[model samples]
Target: MAEAEAGREGGESTLTVLVALGANAAIGVLKLIAGLLTGSAAMLAEAAHSAADTATEGLLLTALRRSSRAADRRHPFGYGKERFFWALIAAVSIFVSGAVFAIYEGIRTIVGEEAEQTAVLVAYVVLAISFVLEGISWTQAVRQLRREAAADELSPMEWLRRTDDPTVKTVFFEDSAALIGLLLAFAGVGLHQLTGSALYDGLASLLIGVLLTGVAYVLGRTNKGLLIGRQADPRLVRALRDDLGARPEVDAVVDLLTMMLGTDQVLLCARLDFDDALGAADLERTCVAIDADLRERFPDLAEIFLEPVPRSDPTMRERVLSRYGESTGLGRPTP
Candidate 1:
């Protein structure tokens, strides 16, 4: 069931990114044409924004593809972190290609270096159309996120922050920034027309740049954390501990550790003390059973190591005794 859900989410995310890519590419061409025809700095900035989004979508597609490669001897942990790395690249592109370009153009326009006295009506039409397309893309991303959050009984914001899939997060933020950029461009164009000043258009472009920068910052930070080997959520850790501790064969769960291998992969290592009566064969069988059960319960647990530590192990018992200044045998059955 977990695997099915992950596949479903992956499909949805792919669809979302494709839709945004198509919309951005189409809008980008139209915006560039409109910007050239109208000579509006705000329209040009919107064009740059759409171009950046299109490029990032392509980058994200590459990330998804590369990250899905099967694990091999060379990369035992798989290529999961590749997604985070490419996503980080996309975020940086947004800052450099989108924000920097917009700000530079805005400054030039503001300084009267490239001011256009006449604003064309076609820019408004293009802005309106771009808004509608971006809105559709944004809606798709939000719907997927909300559906996922509802399954986990989490709020949308909470889910957005906690979701491991960076592709969906990137699309959501990109579309959101696109919407805001459209609004800013609309305002700038409207103000320039009304006040006969190109400064408003330039100011609007600057604001759009700032908005893109902020979105890029968030994306970069999130991907950076994932690339740096962020651990799985605390709730997941607690749940794993509780579930394993509840097993009758387990005398005590000494330690449990989890690491995120990818957006949909996790590595679990558990140190468990089993019943003393369990023979070597029984211990092996028990470990197999536990591994199967854990994988079934959490499909994301790609790799699991169940270390069966004997309760009567002198080294461990002595370590525990030293820490507590007393010996309890740690549930070891007395002869």
Candidate 2:
């Protein structure tokens, strides 16, 4: 059942990427032609923006495919972090291919010889069509986001912050920026036509560059944390601790460590103090049973390690305290 659900979610993410890819590819061509015809700096910046988004979706597709490989001797933990690496590359692509070009174009337009805007109607027509296409892609992204957020009983913004998957998030933000960029281009072209000055057009292009730069930074930081092995959700950690402590064989949960291995996958290590009365064979059987029970209860636990320890041992207590601080109440009995 868990595997089936993961597959379903993966399919949804792939579909989202496909939609954005098609939309951006089409929009980029249209924007490029319109920009050339009208000689509008903002239109050209938007063209570069769409080109960057198209490349980003391709990278995200690669990430989804490569990250789902089965575990092997070479990579016992599997290739889950592949997603983060590729997503990080996508962020860099945005800055290099989109932001830098836009900035340079804006500066050139501002300082270079004055050029007349022509084919104004063509630019307007293309922008209107691009907006509709971008809206379709943006709507798909939002639908997936809301559905996943609802499943986790979280608001959209909260789910976005905590989600392990980056593909949908990337698409959502990219499409959002595309829509906003279209508006900026429209405003720039309109003001340039009215005031007969390229200054407004240049300013709009510069703003587009700043916008893409900000998006790239945000995505890069998100992927960096994922690659560095962020902990599982805090709510899941608390639930796991409580569940383990309630077991009859477990006297205390001395320490519980959890890390995200991939989307919908986690590695957990629990330092547990078991009942002293159990014999060696009984302890072994108990540990096996607990492992099975945990796997059944938490399908997301891709790997689990259980360590037997004395809760009162000074070394163990000190280690847990140092890692989590005294406020955790680990290795201590409840009142």
Candidate 3:
């Protein structure tokens, strides 16, 4: 059942990326034509934005495909982190292709001799059409996110912050920025029409650059954390610790560690103290049984390691203390 659900979500993510890619590809051409016709700095910046988004979608598609490969001898943990690496590249693309161009254009327009705007109506029409197309992509991203959040019993914002998958989040934020960029372009054109100065158009371009820069920073940071091996959700960690502590053979869960292996995948390591009365054979059997129980209960656990240790081992206690400080709750007496 868990595998089926994962496959379904993966399919949805791919569909989302495809939709965004189509929309951005079309939008980029339209924006570029409109920018050239109207000679509007803001419109040109938006064209660059769409181009970056199109590139990003392509990279995200690569991430999804490469990250889904099965484990191999070279990569025993699978290629899950491929998603993070490609997503990181996508973030850099946005900054380089979109943000930098926008900023440079804005500055050039502001300082250079003023150029008269032409075919203003063309810009407006293209912006409106682009808005509709972007809205479609944005709506799809929001729908997927909301459904996933609901399944986890979390608010949308909370889920976004904790989500392991970056593709949907990338689409959602990119479309959102696209929609806002359209509005900024619209306002720039309107202001230029109202007043003969090209200053407003240049300002709009600068704002778009700043916006894309912010989005790039956010996405880059998220992928960086994931690449660095962020832990599984706190709730999942606590639940697994409690379950292990309750086992009949486990005297105490001395230490528990968990890390995200990929989207919907986790790696767990636990140091446990078993009842002293258990024989060596019994200990082996208990470990096997515990591994099976955990795998059944938590389908996300892709790897599990169980270590037996005495609760009173000073070295082990110190190691736990160094890792978790005073909040190291494992092996403590019940209040």
Candidate lDDT scores, in order, read: 0.87, 0.94, 0.93
Misplaced by over 4 Å in model 1 are 1-3, 309-335
Task: Write one digit per residue (lDDT tens) for candidate 3, span 106-223.
Answer: 9988999999999999999999999999999999999999999999999999999999999998998899999999999899889989998899999999999999999999999999
Name the lDDT value of residue 78 in candidate 3: 94
Most accurate candidate by lDDT = 2
Compose the digit string of candidate 1's lDDT tens values, residues 162-222: 8788999999999999998999999999998888888999999999999999999999999
My TM-score estimates for the predictions, one after another, are 0.89, 0.98, 0.98
- Residue-level lDDT tens digits of model 2 in 1-335: 99999999999999999999999999999999999999999999999999999999999999999999999999999899899899999999999999999998899999988889999999999999999999999999999999999999999999999999999999998999989889999999999999999998998999999999999998999999999999999998998998899988888899999998999999999999999999999999998998999899989999999999999899989889999997877998633
- Candidate 1, pairs of clashing residues: none
TM-score of 1: 0.89
lDDT sort, best first: 2, 3, 1
After superposition, the stretches of candidate 2 with alpha carbons farther than 4 Å from their true spots are none
